[model samples]
Target: MVAPGTLLLLGPLLAALPGLGQGQGQGQGRQRRPPPTQSPLEKVAAQEELSLPQLAGKWFLVGMASHCSYLAEHSHQLEATAVTVTVLDGQSLAISTFRKLDGMCWEIRQRYLPAQAHGRFLLKGRGYGSKVDVVVGETDHSSYAILYYQKGRSISVKLYGRTIRVSDAVVDKFEQRVSAVGLSEDMTYYFPTYGFCDSADEFHILDETKP
Candidate 1:
C-alpha cells in the first residue's frame, strides 16, 4: 500500500506552481505558516568510485519510497517514471526528471555536482528547500541500480534498470537498500510496470532550467 503522506517531499516545489504557492491567492489571507522542519532522512555516505560513462543515458524508474505525490493525477498503473542523466564534461551530470507534478507531465532539469565523495553529489537545482544529496547503490553500470536522495524533510529511494521490468533479485537488493536507509515497510510504493514511458502524448518535456 502507498503511504499517502509521502507527498510531503514534493511539497514546497509543487506548491510553488501557479496558484499553488503557500498563501498568494485572493480572498485567502492571514493564513499561518508551516512549522519548522526537521527531516528524519539523513544523508548516506557516498561510495568510493562512480563511473560517469556507465551511469549516463535514460534509466527506467521502477520503484520509489518517498513523500512525493508525483502521480497525483494518475494511478500506479497509468504510466512510467524515469530519468536521463547526461554526462557533462568530466565530473558532473545533467539530470532530467520526468514525472507528473501539479496535474501535468513535467521535466525538471538540474545539474548534479560532485560533493565530498565519489558516489555522492549535491543537486544544483532550485525549488528544493535545500541541497539534495544523491547516493548511488551497487551498480555494474549495465543493468539494475538503486538511488537514494535525502534533503530537507524528504527521503527518496528509487530503483532503476535498463528496462522497465527487472529480476526479483534486483528488487530484493533495492529493498535492502531502502531498509538500510531506515525506510519502514509502509513507506514503499512500487510503480506499476505499464511500459507507458514510450507513449508520445503521455509525456511532454518541459525545461525548468536553474540559473
Candidate 2:
C-alpha cells in the first residue's frame, strides 16, 4: 500500500519517460532525413511575383552594365539578333537566342522557370562557354530590363524601351534601380540591337503616345 503522494510522483515520471524517448527518436529520424531537392534558382525565384505572358517574345540585349571583368570588357558588344521565348502549357518555358559578337555568331537554348517569382521570367542557358541565367522582364509599362548572369559568376543588365528609345528621366530612374541592386554604373554599357531603330545611333527616344 503506497501513499497517494508517492504514486502521483511516480506516475508523472513514468509518463515523461516515453515522451523523452519519442523526442529523441524524432531527432534521430530527422537527422537521417535527406536534404530537399530544388533547382539552383528556385529559392531566388520564390521571392518575386512574375506573370506568364509577359515573358513571351524576343527581348533584345539593348544594353549591359556591370562591374564584373567579362562584362566590363564586352558589355554591349554582343547583339542579340533574335530571341525566341515560348511557354509550354503554362508549366515551363523554352528560350532560344542568336547573338553576334566580334563578327562571330552563336545560338543559346534553355528551359526554365516553371514557377514564377518576382516580376520576371527566369531561365538558364549556356552560351559562349558560360552558363547564363536570363531574366527577361518589365518593371513598369514604359521600361524593361533583362539580366544575363554569365558563367554563373557575373551579371549584365540590359535596358529596353517600349518605343524607339527610353526617355532621359526613365534611363535615370532605371540606372538608379540598377545601382540600388548593387551593380556598378561605370562598367555599364548600352546595346541597341533591334526594335524601332535600325542603327545604334538611331537609338533615340520618341513619344509613342503621340500617334
On lDDT, the leading prediction is: 1
Tens digit of per-residue lDDT, candidate 2, span 7-101: 77886686577543234653453224358665333323221445556656655545556667775576545454555557777856665555544
Q: Which candidate number would show the highest TM-score if scored against the true structure? A: 1
Candidate 1 root-mean-square deviation in Å: 12.8
Worst 10 residues of 1 by lDDT: 194-203
TM accuracy, model 2: 0.52
The C-alpha lDDT values of all candidates are 0.70, 0.51
TM-score for each prediction?
0.67, 0.52
In the order shown, the candidates' Cα RMSDs to the true structure are 12.8, 15.8
Worst 10 residues of 2 by lDDT: 202-211
